[model samples]
Target: MAIIHYFAPMMKMRIFGLVFLGMAAACYNPPRNCNDFKEGEFRFTTVVGENEQTTTFIRRKSIEIDYYQEKADTSSIRWINDCEYVVKKINPKTPAEEKSIHMKILSTTDSSYTFEYGLVGSSKKSRGTAFKVN
Candidate 1:
């Protein structure tokens, strides 16, 4: 009888702790500073076939030029919003390369943004974090 009384309060406390934790997690939100990431020199790092690669790009309001592996490629940007845009290769050399890519900033910090991107009209998505260099 005494053990039941002791365990009942312990169980209630445990349940209350779990509820508090869940509420805290549910209310958590990531920071965003969309305007800071809109136009700048940025570096994006990703893994490709067991190798890590980083690409650097300089963006203006409507254009971006990417430098990677001794090559430079330019793209036109169409803004959907302050935090979202579509990019198309300005001088694509192949059909696959001509597809416009959809990009959306998921969250931002003072110097970086987490983004999700995919080819326009495609369901597959990829995520990357880009850091502002300038």
Candidate 2:
């Protein structure tokens, strides 16, 4: 009976510790500077086919022009909020490219923002961090 009493308090303490740790982890938050990223020249680097590829884009009020792999394409931007927008290829060459991409800024730093984007209405998402170049 005495050993059972001692173990009961120990179990409670362990459970309480776990709960406190969970709460502390939940409190962590990332930074965002949506307005600063709204209009700028930015660079994004991603791994493609085992090679690091970089793309540059200039975003204005409602349009974005991207230069990638020696090709330039224009896209239209529709802002849903300060930190979210949808982008569609201005002149899509294929049906797949006609899908609009939904982008949300998840976090930001002094000169960059981490974002997640996917085709609108799709469940799969891709994340990337973009840095302001100018």
Candidate 3:
């Protein structure tokens, strides 16, 4: 009886350890896939500290991305699928510099999608999941 009592504690400890390890493994899992996020046009709007901005993009051979805000003219970027692109500010200011931005589609679902992107000359990396508009 004494031996069974001592082993009971060890058995419970082992089972508890297994449960924790299982949860940790699930947390480290990768996303589903990236195929779903490709080949589509998307529009996104965000309210950043009382200022609202919108972005539109078409993920195609001639990929086009545009940005617009209140009281500002539309700006745009034209891209080719060869991992290269050109960006221009369409407003009449400064003749719009030509720059390049890096973007990658991460994973997607029926109503939401995630991506990794960065603007030109900026070292900050950005990632976010966005929902489709009705």
- Give the number of the best model, judged by TM-score: 2
* Sort by TM-score, top down from the best: 2, 1, 3
After superposition on all CA atoms, how large is the RMSD of candidate 3? 5.4
Return the top candidate by lDDT: 2
* Per-residue lDDT of candidate 3, residues 1-134 (tens digit): 99999999999999999999999998884454444444456677667789876766554444343435434334354554433344455444553343445665556678667666776768886776655543
| Candidates' RMSD to native | 2.2, 2.1, 5.4
Write the candidate numbers in order of decreasing lDDT: 2, 1, 3
**lDDT on C-alpha atoms for all candidate structures:** 0.94, 0.97, 0.58
lDDT of 2 by residue, 36-58 (tens): 99999999999999999999999
Error of 3 at 81 (Å): 11
TM-score pick, better of 1 and 3: 1
lDDT of 1 by residue, 12-82 (tens): 99999999999999999788778898789999999999999999999999999999997999999999988
Give the runs in model 3 whose Cα sits over 4 Å from its true position: 1-27, 70-97, 120-123, 132-134
Backbone collision tally, model 1: 0
The TM-score between candidate 1 and the true structure equals: 0.83
